[model samples]
Target: MMVLLISTSIMFSCKEKANVLKESIEADIIIYGGTSAAISAAVEAKRSGKSVIVVSPDKHLGGLTSGGLGWTDTGDKSVIGGLAREFYHRVYKYYNTDEAWQWQPKEEYGNTGQGTPAMDGENRTMWIFEPHVAEKVFEDLVKEDSIRVDRDEWLDRENGVVLEGGNIKSFSTLSGKTYSGKIFLDATYEGDLMAAAGVSYHVGREGKDVYGEEWNGVQTGVLHHKHWFESDISPYVVPGDPSSGLLPRVSAENPGEKHSGDDKIQAYCFRMCMTDHEPNRVPFPKPDGYDPMQYELMARVFDTGRKDWFQKFDAIPNHKTDTNNHGPFSSDNIGMNYDYPEASYERRKEIIKEHEQYQKGLLWFVANDPRVPKDIQLKMQKWGLAKDEFTDNGNWPHQIYVREARRMVGEFVMTENELLKKRKTPNPIGLGSYTMDSHNVQRYIKPDGFVQNEGDIGVETNGPYTISYGSLVPKKNECKNLLVPVCVSSSHIAFGSIRMEPVFMILGQSAAAAAVLAINENTTVQNVDYNKLKEVLVAKGQIVE
Candidate 1:
């Protein structure tokens, strides 16, 4: 490996002349994300005797795992194997020490998970944890494995990647640093590298006819979750007055027909880390653009005798809760993130800021607004941002949950048919058992002139299902050296199941194993020997059923 340094002069906003230094590093494998999957891939690559580097736009690792989704969306514990399970095992080890449980006693903390033990004694795994603890565990892995991670290095999506003969030769970041590798893994939620490399991908939901699947497209009538407005709440500012204009956040467009295709995606929100503990709680600050009228619909919903604002206040360790979007109008700023999938970096930052402002304002409204029910207001006031977590970023999560993004159209596509056990999957690399869950894509006026949210679907998989290896690699003609674990080749509905954090780590390990094999055999990633790859993965304790 060699590092080449290049120097250039650039002018900044202040018109100040500064020297821009660029470094080009060569490695056997290049992982272009700081997600949990990216860490796992780097660990696997190092174990296979390959030099690897993690070029991440994020300062922190573990994506949502280290972010605030600490509730753990994993379905079956048995399916989580290899490095993914090892990660949980590390969490268990962390908690075994007295220092890990700072807010509560270890014995007093009750064990609770998704129908599983929060602290699994038999398997030596811990499922539920705080956000900082998860980040620490991931950081420990990087340290122990000596994995090099370059933080806050954004990929130049428009003109960064260089492809030669259907393979990526090298890719440069906005920092002007270039990375050349024999194989690359796009483990990011946004699939920035894959998109910049000219790989085919899909952003929106496909019609049922295209995939021959029931849950692929716009779902108008299905009410899987309690996220929709229960009562016939008016969409207008004045009740039943169309000329009064639509209420804030409610879409003016008509919700399309059921099962029809549309270029819409599920809403995104920050899985807020909140605590009610007296010493650790930081009171919600009223955002800059806090608008009381924005939550007028929620206030009306409360008038209809509903007080379930704390329904999804899922508990984590140390009195912290991974508070999520709940009810008709809650943390989810619906329909505001449709342009985020393919938007520019600058535009994406604006969207993120808008989401943060909307969610923060919602919390502040619930805590202080007189329009809210007195009981709800008092309860919300008790909880605040955790003081011990995210200290660098105003006690809020640093990453926003990009629930779904650009999914690569690779050699194989995982669909609901495979998830529902109607069709057999091939070349099993990992197992995904989470429910096929997708949040509402749009909130629009119903034919009855009432506001309603659409596209929320939650259907449980029959059991743990195998994820194919082909889902990770692009088509042979498209890109030979790249593998995508986070944005795998799958239909929108099927991706809901595969998008879980543990499954992403599993696929990351599998992708790394395949890349190592391809590098050893001097073949394309598509041409890697599956039998040998499966053998190596299983030997490493991966669940490759």
Candidate 2:
């Protein structure tokens, strides 16, 4: 009897192990990202009666939206619709509650906003918010929708996507977990999934003639924003000694010809969330390898009597500010992130850490260093990182804003023509109205022997223009079951406008709806009927044209 009992127990244990092996996860749609787009896509899929999962490399959701970028980059509020606008309305609803205001009184935080009213009482939309509030909103969306999110599931880019006859059967992550789906959406900023799937994409600025775009290439001559140095700053380590070599952050290479194309990408910076409220502030700590001489150029710029030091301290709520890069030498670690687009996971982590150290050191220098102007240093001392935010990541934002990355060269390549409304957009999925904005791509030596920042262009679109549905999908031959919304097919200049968080949610919802439509019809994503898709999108309140 004892022998039989032991044998039966062993048998049960083996069966349990087998059951665990058999319990692999599967979904109708698999969204690979944790950006705002990923959440929208998952919610839309659930609403359409399809099971979806969000497998992301990031631990947090909502990307930059929940990161430090609380001040919205919205161009036209009317163009935002569907799940995108719904999100803002939810933000409005959250703030409406008495408990939502923690650090400040609701009445005190009056009706100040950007171009439009931030606290819109009529339409019920709130554009600007705190970072933690945005994150909570995203978390509420996932919980309310009952969406499954697998965080920190890094995609095995080398050999993970198992494609069967141009269709992704499944993809594995570095964690040895595999997710299977009928339809897939690559909602990542870097377009990692699309790149891994062998989809065609462009990394840097395309030549002007490639897409017949005026702002597509090396824009050395154009100076749109006040980001460039107003007066020429010497690039030498010693004031005028070229033999002393270039100073830190100043590249010695020649900036390419004006309007010529190159592989350089725009500068990226952390949109810092700082507060003067001492109770909720963490003083900036000196980072390892702190070098005060690195910012010599900025010190010189300040010495030139430019007192607009606090120009871009865009305010949010609760005495906090969305501090962005402003002036010639500010928060933007320019020309240091060239390898981030195609970098490996480990390499990318290193880059992110490097940025974090640089920014932290900069803040420390501005507040405490004797080299900084006395007036500016005194003012900066009052501001520090919000202690209530990003508790898991040391009060710093988890995600850096990847302004531009690998853009899928899908069926329709959105250029300035489409943005400027020179050509009609076909099968409209969403609308984008933000200016064709691009930050300085490279800070290099000019021909006249002075340091200058290049590739900052800002040209307003004629009006709200439709984003093509074709831009979301890979070429019909490349992959039929995949949709890329965040990294949609667009030129470098065009993406600067479409890369907004709200626009991403709009396209993400559209992509999810299309995926469901394709699944229902037993057809490929490319073969889904546009008329049928439009009907569903309109019903869902998408701004489809």
Candidate 3:
């Protein structure tokens, strides 16, 4: 009797373990992210006749696209194709309706974009749109395809991924839900899944020598944008007194050698979706721990007769604006997010909150502070947060503009040479033509004890350059079944151009197609035939030139 009872207990224990490991949801492809790339990948996977699941960390769909980055950074609209171009076409269709324009009429919203018409009638595509409209388009894309999206499902980065023979077998989330798949795609901006999978990746800037690129690393005394302190402003709390202590936001450390390597990355900021319309404007709330002293440097910048505060308030539909970091001291919180790429989730939240507080405080200071120039203050006061956008998050964007992060060091690493037309890209999958841009990395005191900004680059590419297929796959030895579209394999300078949302969508579609081909051939993503992949890409409206 005792032996029989012990046997029963052992049997039950083994059964429970099996149940725990069993995947709650299984599919042909499992995508980890909620960004625009994730949506595009999921849609493509479904269109390819495969079961797909998106384990999204965010409740929302689009990352920065629907997160206040309405002003598209499209370099050459002609090169954008596949689902990416489809997205813009959907936007154009939405705006063609009478009800789409709520706060303003379609005629009043002029066809102004970044050197192109906002609504390109000939191509039936719209580049510029409001945040809510972008989100709706993303939501519709998923809904139309009937894609399974598990929202707010945070990946258990510590012990989630289960790999077998260089392939991911399954991964669990914080909710204890196991997801099994034939192939995996990491579409997050931070490359969380890629890093968690133990694939090789690099954070921050690589030295110019690392990739033989001119704009890869630390760039002191080289200011391409207007985001530098043109005037001689002292870094000290009290002007010309080093003993008085450094002012807030100004770094005390040594700005590294020019063109040398450093761990610093470009500054990040909330692309504030603001509106001057009285009916739909919500005043910028004073953040929880608002401090006026933080804006003293900004006030000093204004004192220098710089009236370009509203320079980057790029217009969108509905009388709204996609306000980005402009002048010397604006939205880009300089020198505050070095550890964000690899920080713990809790720590990242803290950092994001700090950025939010800093930006909100900056807006409040500009609108109400006595030190601000009366002319600028009056103009700023007219603008406020769009009442209808991001209503769940206090009318502030949920996604931060994480311009660059963990770039994978995979089988092929794109360099400035490829973008500059010096070296030809192999196994082209998509195209990118945006300027090799990087926001200011650090703000430090110059050799003469004056304040200055560093690491703001804006070198235009030769033209539309092809993106290599290898840039999306890992070295076969590292991870065979995993595909990374967002944090692609490229040098920092090259990633500057590839990090655009349209390119991400393009890569996402290409990655999904590659994943399906790999599954069909029973081979690794690295082993998928380039010719077969290119055929599918072109057939699916992807311009791979």
Q: Candidate 3, residues 136-245: lDDT per residue as tens digits?
A: 99999999999888899989999999889999998889876778889999999999989888999999889988989998898887889999999999888899999999
Deviating ranges (above 4 Å) for candidate 1:
1-18
Against the true structure, what is each candidate's TM-score?
0.98, 0.95, 0.96
lDDT of 1 by residue, 1-545 (tens): 52545666564766566777778888999999999999999999998899899999999999999999998999998999999999999999998998988898888777787778888898899999999999998899889988889999999888889999999999999988999999999999999999999889999899999779999798987898899988888989999999999888988887777788888999999999999998998999999978989889888998898988999999888988988889888888899999998999999999999999989988998899888889889888999999999999999899999999899999999999999999999999999999999999999888888889998999999899999999999999999999999999999999999999999999999999999999999999999999999999999999988
Off by over 4 Å in 2: 1-23
Q: Relative to the true structure, how large is the alpha-carbon lDDT of every model?
A: 0.92, 0.89, 0.92
Best by TM-score: 1
Best to worst by TM-score, what's the order?
A: 1, 3, 2
Question: In candidate 1, how many Å is residue 261 off?
Answer: 1.1
Clashing pairs in 2: none
Instruction: Report residue 525 deviation for candidate 1 (angstroms).
Output: 0.6
State candidate 2's TM-score. 0.95
lDDT of 2 by residue, 1-545 (tens): 00101111122463464222222468899999999999999999998899899998999999999998888998888888999999999999998998888888888885567678778888899999999899898999999988889899989999999999999998988866788889999999999999999999988888888889888899887889999888877889887789998889988777777667788888888999999988898998789999988878888898788888899888787888888888888888888889998999889889888889888988988898887889999999999999999999899999898998899999898999999989989999889988989988888888888888988889999779999999999998999999999999999999989998899999999999999999999999999999999999998899876
